[model samples]
Target: MHGLVLAALAVLVSLTAAASLNAATIGKANSTNCVMLIGGEIVQGDFEKFVTIGKLLLPGDDGESTRRNTVCLASSGGSLSEGVKFAKYFYDNGIGTVIDDGQECYSACAIMFMMGTATGAEVSFANRKLHVGGKLGFHRPYLRISPGESIDSSAMQIAYDAAFSSALDLIAVANSKSPWSSQPMMKSDLVQRMLQHVGNDMFMIDTVDKVGRWDIEVFGSSEPSLLSEEQAFYACENSLQWQNGLTKGDITYSNVSDGPNGKRRSQSLSKETRQAVYQVEGLASGYAMESCVISRKKGTIFGCGIDEYSDARLGQGDCDHSNFADRSSSLKAISVFNPATKLEDLRTGQAVVAVQSGAARCFVIKGSQITDNEPCLVIHVGDAKVRGRASTITHFVWPSGSKTVLVQSGTSFEINGVSTGKRTVAERGDCYLNSATLNDFCVLTSPN
Candidate 1:
């Protein structure tokens, strides 16, 4: 299993040959009008490279037509910061950038799709791997089934049809010009088109979270949530419309919300489950060896190493040794993000990396990528629990013999009286402390 996981990690977050174009020499403007900036090298000052490309693509002479033909970008996302700058530059300037060639753009390059165009200009994607991910843990809602668990025929039929059509429509829309207008597409056709046209260029929507267009706005989030119904459906295994309207295998936000039976009180995962999610996926190292791979600075929480921190101390660097924190739905299937939040800002449910331990310890921004050497996120999808028909996790912790707790941070817990400092109960995975628990609070547990 370890080997298999490592192998999978290798394939998912590959370290591409780093390359970038020489800075635009500062003074030479190309007459070709539209500049083709091929990120041939792994970009160090990635955004600057895109800015160079942007220079040639200003608004037209009349401020209407594109000043330059267009900027053609080719390369994987080496620097998310740089990629965002490039994308924003194009969007702000009202010019469309193209991802072309056999180049695979991952990471921040996925933002290439975030252009706010009125006409919904043709965002062509071909033979590119837009694998976007970040280090962010996820919260899988509690799920369970009783002895006579079953679905009603009529309800089940409605669910099945909704699911089938939703799947078809989603595929058609993603692949077709306007998915809504294309009606529905066959599963095979959708996959074929995605593989053919998108190749590895665009994101390969895998987990149920990403099935929905809205669930996942960015790659890394605290709790990887299904932004949309599509994401929720596909995320479940053999999804079924239970008698309660909740999919059998799917976990809902309500399950993680404040309730008698939900994850609002504590870390829903058990020790084994936590360990399972945190299992090392792979190992990566840089050839740059002049400086020790591990470096410790005063006031930092942990020693910094190239494995998780950038060898080149260009800016603040990706990983902050003083603080190490990460959250990933890929490893744990928990993506928690808000659409309004910028990639620069971190929000709840998003896994974080920060100073291991220190008064000033804080979660900082570390580019999201499993193979990038930085600490990667391991998603843990907790077992499902059902209530009324909708399934949710029952992560309540109670004292020896007591009830009544609080729902804090969206975790469910059982307490005797008013108690503080709660933790995961034990292996069976029930966190009970029997304190004067009122509102369910989210619980923290040891990481794998």
Candidate 2:
């Protein structure tokens, strides 16, 4: 980060007496780092200037090890096409981005800032002599709906298509970058939600707390990485805020016991409403955990839901055991199952047999990408490939011919399923099982 700050100062020292470039500016202050300044509204030609300048100032194409690049952007935002181009430049160049004090990085500017992480670039804020308080914002892509005019089906279809295309571009940029270096900038669902969260078309990610929520590695020079493996597991577990209609008191607390070799205690909060929240703390297992919500009234469920399935945080130990979709694979299969009804809704009393999918003998999916495909479930039970989805998997027969059934138990353990007095089914007892999705279930005959 010091190198980044110094690079910024170098840019300030080299700028002309005008004090403002009002356009994308680039210059080389030293042998190791190039400083780029993007100001005003970003539009066409900025990306070309950035690339051409990088090639001119940075010198070698393989300066990845020797040369460091810092980019400072102050803009309101403009043309999504140009924003995409700008992001592509940053992703390709792996240039760091910064927003010093008094600088405004709103809308597309914020999007570009997030894109910086895709390339494993350091992004920060400076508030020293020439800098002001920094601001990073997000909003839905600019919509072209005419004022006071209703959109016809065809026009609405076109808008939806454009928005969908933008989402795909964002996902591609995120997936192209490795999670170890880049970290999760944001989840696909968050992108979709933030794009529609506000009517004014802006969602400012100004506070450190808000920025901490996203899959980001760097926020400011003073701030540390927010999406560490432990932090991500923490985020997955307690990330949900009690919303309207949900009372704070309705959420209860319970202590974890230290008796089990794995000393983890989970506090369950049951609501008069359909949702229930559970907080698991002090998990001893090396496996990571993610918090999930299930509807007691609904008969289906999915672990973590759309908001928690972070593609950017996938390989960062949070979901290391689960296999990922290949890079060349596109989400070609569309799932006919309505996720909410078929997944989120828990059956009246169905047993849940959650299993962790690791490199060893485990359940395999037909497709790697869960977002675009139905991923048919194939479990390796003994020497046979047993076909079953997570929800469809009901019974797990022990090696001794004893069977454990997955019954819908409000708490973690089920009493009626196995007839073993009180057998632990899922939850904190097994971290791998704790994180498994409703459709990711498998029967493990042995730990190996």
Candidate 3:
């Protein structure tokens, strides 16, 4: 039985090697002019054909290489060595890769997808897109040994070494930093997750969390409904915050606008901030809005939520009779009143704290004494209360702070305020504020 098993493994390895030498088909895809599809088993000649196609499509004439040239991949995986070579070529030449809708890329093919890059001024993983309907899976590289095969110690050791080398090469490729952007082509977490699964099984990039954490773009689908967006946003936001060592919790959206056809939209844009609000059903607050703010310059998204009853004018009495009457709060504690809530309940001398810009600073809110002493480029206060709620005579006061000079120096910012100075280091797509001025500010430009 052992002899038969060994013979079977030998035959399987030979057949696999022979099959992997055949060139994969590479040609213009029907979907787009710039997209070339690489289908079937990847092998020896595929890399040459890919380079040929890439050169023909992206001739170095007058910066033509900067054009969008994508290689959409569809394969069950073949030669790992060839895959590494192709991935290196893609990275060096800024060639994008994609798994189109309904297609699949696994193992070696998936490695190529992850290392793909796009030609642009800044480092962007947007080119390595995996369509919502497509599948991208990974697993540890393995030898082509038959199950239950009885192999000699030397042969087994050789196979194990080969697999180990492949894995190390993969890690090296993933950790390689881009010459221009200094960002890793692929994150370590992604590579670690890929190596967790055995050769016979796969760890699929099936969840939205996986896709976002890996920074893989998704397309071929319209924006989800508010409910779905709310859930997905929370999950993604939690993941991002956890990764960044930031706190995570339930967010609030204080302002909401009802659009045509029962849809609600909230948008606010300035030199410093761009905010979008989506109305969603809330179990605790009855009616809620999921608010997301994007740093115009940094491209980081800060999201929170707001409940209908948060508005002070829509107090306990009024909320009990409104559409969200079922979720009306019975509590009488004033401490539960958030910055956007209990506005009408504020007394003559009550002090309330509200976040000015991205949690950069908090100011004391007292009736008609609103001050704008801060040197912020933009200060957005959610004034629009719950939809169709009755107006109130009480007006909410805004906060005031100090003037500051913001200077960008590499990945860090130096803020010189009137009384004190502080420095903040930021990662790409992260929002930060100055502790000196209590001004919310984020880096909008990429590091040089």
Query: Which structure among the candidates has the greatest lDDT?
Result: 3
TM-score per model over all chains: 0.23, 0.39, 0.50
Error of 2 at 258 (Å): 14
Per residue, candidate 1 scores C-alpha lDDT tens digits across 1-448 of 5544433222222112233335322222242322454444333465665466446544433333343434444444433333434544544444444433223434334443333121223432111111233221111111111246454445444444543443343333333222223322113332343334322244343333332232232332233211221122112211111101212332322212233543221111113311211111001222332111111122111111122322322122233322323311121132222112233232234332321211110111122211111112222224343232322222221110111223333344223333344444332122333333233332323322
**Shift in Å, residue 239, candidate 3:** 7.2
Q: What is the C-alpha local distance difference test score of each model? A: 0.29, 0.38, 0.48
What does candidate 2's lDDT look like per residue over 241-329, in tens digits? 21111112222211223355533343333433223233334223234333332212232211232223232221122211122212111
Runs off by more than 4 Å, candidate 3 = 1-22, 58-67, 120-126, 147-153, 178-183, 224-239, 242-448
Sort order, TM-score high to low: 3, 2, 1
Per-residue accuracy of model 3 over 1-448 as CA lDDT, tens digit each: 5654444334221112123444678888766623688888886567888888767665332243433768888887777767888888877677778888678888888888887776655444335877767888887665665568677765565555655666667678877774465557676767777668866478887644455446666665322111223222343233323233222243432222234443322222332222232222332332443222211112222232333333222112222112332322211111111212212222232232332333232221123231221112222222232224321111112211112233333333343422223334343223335454354433322332
lDDT of 2 at 134: 62
Q: Which one wins on TM-score?
A: 3
Q: Candidate 2: worst 10 consecutive residues by lDDT?
A: 327-336
Model 3 residue 59 distance off true place after TM-score fit, in angstroms: 5.1
Residue 98 in candidate 3, Cα distance off native in Å: 0.9
Better of 1 and 3 by TM-score: 3
Q: What is the lDDT of residue 47 in candidate 2?
A: 75
